[model samples]
Target: MSGDAAGGLESHDYDVVVIGAGGSGLRAAIAAHEAGARVAVVCKSLLGKAHTVMAEGGIAAAMGNRWKEDNWEVHFRDTMRGGKMLNHWRMAQLHAQEAPDRVLELETWGALFDRTEDGLISQRDFGGHKYARLAHVGDRTGLEMIRTLQQRTVALGIDVFMECTVTDLLKDTGAAEDRVAGAFAYWRESGRFVVFRAPSIVLATGGIGKSFKVTSNSWEYTGDGHALALRAGASLLNMEFVQFHPTGMVWPPSVKGLLVTESVRGDGGILKNADGKRFMFDYIPEFFKAETADSVEEADRWYDDKINNRRPPELLPRDEVARAINSEIKAGRGSPHGGIFLDIASRRSPEFIKRRLPSMYHQFKELADVDITAEPMEIGPTCHYVMGGVEVDPDTEQSGVTGLYAVGECSGGMHGSNRLGGNSLSDLLVFGRRAGEAAAAYAEGTARSRPTVAEADVAVAQERALAPFSGGEKASENPYTIQSELQQTMNDLVGIIRTAAELEESLVEIEAYQERARHLIVEGHRQYNPGWHLALDLANMLLVSECIAKAALARQESRGGHTRDDFPGPDPTWGAKNLVLSLDATGTGVNLKEQPLPVMPDELKEYFA
Candidate 1:
């Protein structure tokens, strides 16, 4: 609501504009402000209530606080291998090299991490880590991370527009190659429109998980950034790699898909079938077999003696564990609630469980009426994260479009095909700072020739955003119904395990949903209307769903988060390539093209060799 009138529309100008208030967005804003740039952060939720607070595991970093052998090189190797070697080598390298420094930087900015016996920042075990490498604050690491970052942002005096939703990216038509000039947004409270005019825009808007029916994502994660980037002529990479987390609550209907943090498994939890057998050992892939324990005895011994024994199969990458759980459910070995059992009760004492994973313990006790200290929790795969997002530069996080940047869960290539648990927080810090610094530099360079927001473009965006309100009361199409159908379509056909037939059928259903969405009608006034807001968000979800489905079908190989039932194994040919999604010429459909993966230097390739 704070802006000056520009051509009769409310407009605010800044050097850099960040489109989220999560961990990445806050870090970016702080970085830009420190670099002497006037920055503005716009978010769809309150300051401390972003989906980032929902991250319960620790920040992955090679601090080596607990393990002497841990370092950046090992972290790099683990990331590349965990991602199935499809990662952009430079991004993975940079992330690993910088993560420790970023974590320590958070402490300097007043983050209070759990301490080791020697008084160093404590590091804990997580899936895909070669050592205990997660810097944590018990199980509420993300909550503490957000608290620290929010304080840093406030201390820097960066402007924040809370409860604001961006509907479109405004491009400057005057430039020979169109560049992002600003953004079109609306206040979630009053439904009043506002425009942010900036030379550089950083999209830290997270992922597309909410498009699926059962997901760990909050309602605000409707793929707004992905759709905005596509419409602004930026391409998304690896849209097929949608990560369904292995442990989402599945017992009670209401809390189904709520996340069960990886901390549970990291702190000695194990997965079991209905017959009370440890099942993850049977699902370890050939690639991971060399480093994974083949028997229960060694896996258990690993907890106390890390130097000699291989890690547990329960600590495999998310995609592997999720697929294993899905297979167990389908094979009739699942719990009564149609999921596998995640038990930490028998392995660890009640006091240890509460001290290590207080959040997970309470989440189950309050929501599902299950006690983690005594019984197993019924859990299954739920759409958690999308490794696909705006394709950005490895060093600066800038997209192909000038003056536009993306970071965190809204950017691709850093995680490649699968993200290791705890790595997400570190990715946000590393890339968020790079993007903010780069955006500030770009904004300064363009000060003399800043792109102008065309009044005409703003008018078009406003019309599209307000269209749902004008539909008659008797209109047959309902926004909520269309959204529900779309979610079910994605969950049923394009979920954890997919087939060519189901993928094709999903595309057809998506098209029908699109038609229904076009005629969407909401029965409410513009002010504080949830239905109208959903109507606007539906467009983003539908567009992103098409990208996911099309990319999944075209990939034609099983790898990482994307598993094709017909093509059950990873194909060498597809492993060396990436699929990029862009808007078609008409800007009404998506087009996909195969691009060669970035070649790793011989020095770095030695890790895989």
Candidate 2:
């Protein structure tokens, strides 16, 4: 298998292949290795440079270090409320219960989080939580977490294949069980094809935010994991719910879509309109009425005394805040840069600002040339995370396809309709470990002998991957043009606010892009060619875009990240179901199915009551 002369592909064998090197992938590889399975991690970029490094906010866990009253039950309740009760209860419960240990485990692996006065890990405030719960390190928590996990993986002697992109998941069709047989990938530097023959494949490739025009996500997130799962006969859940973070830098055109971490508002930043009014107070929804401050006095005072007073309206859940910001900008009350003003300069001391958000301070001072210590920063919504991906078993993290697993932002059901601010980090840790352990066990228990890879599948995969270089008549289509059009279409039509008409129009546009993607042209050879890479990425983006538009059109109600202007409220019937997307048996089209929500156990129901 090492020398496949027919396809000119190099082959390697491992018990488990983890197709990502971000937080989840590294953690999964480490766990699989510990479970006695030979493991390898394949990533498209250099280790430690995955998009996880861009995360600023801390991980959320009920460590009970900052607040004695905080516990997993409270965290679970907040998560459910944040997701508007659309979350898979078991996944949410597992995340909440296991997040603390995961955080502590990171610390043991040399992640130095900010320490409290009591010498414990420090916790900070964030939106959609009952108490201060984010374990941070000067707003660069992800960098520290990724570094620590990478170091741990190295120490555990796990194999890592950097700069590799997995194009397809190979499976055994002749066998009784259609389990994963291997994966086909190409080296980014050399453009040579390679295959990994493994009994289990774990897809930790992150979100699909790159499909939108204004996104905080990096280029690595092109729905690769989502598309791979779909084409591999797996289901995707809740694709309609895409989270738009409320605060992204709207000034300095070059950094227009860059993220402004929620830690700003968490640390007492206020949102104001051009009229100098705290506009968030007027935009508080009834859903948060019981917990939010209705007036400026209470809100300002609550910052000093969070125990007795309600939280500020500026600290509302991301979906609500993003919608309010969108409304403000549209109503001619926005800042000069077409966004709202976030003022932390007047709210906190300059020293505290620099200490707590060093990266944010540098980001503004260097990029926008505005000293955030003296002036407000203009910000708006940016596509940050997707609360949807491959559908999986809550406990095992295995998808519908046998021996295929997904974790991190690529897996669905943990965050439900909208993800909370700090939940993404913890979600990766808890579920990544779960996926690794489960995949290792499955591989060891079932894979008694080496699985066979079909030569026909390899031929088809190679043909599909190299079609862009064929220079056929249809190859005149430019990949960049189609990608840009698709981004703008998703951004405008299926963005923060949606209607049936716009979504239908988006579907039509997506179809056009899909057709263009088939004939995409790459001018240069494959070696380090970005055009060739994006040509491949466009297919995943278009497929995921179709799923989002179709699901958004079908769900005629507002819930969490998915807002329908035509149907302004959540429908009980829609709330009880999850929109599941899968590939049609023909493998040419997508099939949408509605799966009923799982019933919550009587014991867990008491928490909500």
TM-score of 1: 0.98
Candidate 1 local Cα displacement, residue 433, angstroms? 0.2
Q: What TM-score goes with each of the models?
A: 0.98, 0.98
At residue 573, candidate 2 shows an lDDT of: 96
Give the per-residue lDDT digits (tens) of candidate 2, residues 231-272: 999999999999999999998998888999999999999999
Model 2 lDDT, full chain set: 0.91
Per-residue CA lDDT of model 1 for 105-201, tens digit only, reads: 9999999988999999999999999899999999999999999999989888899999999999999998997699999999888778899999899
Question: Each model's RMSD to truth, in Å?
Answer: 2.3, 2.1
lDDT of each: 0.92, 0.91
Give the per-residue Cα lDDT of candidate 1 at 236.
96
Which runs in model 1 stand beyond 4 Å of their true positions? 1-8, 472-475
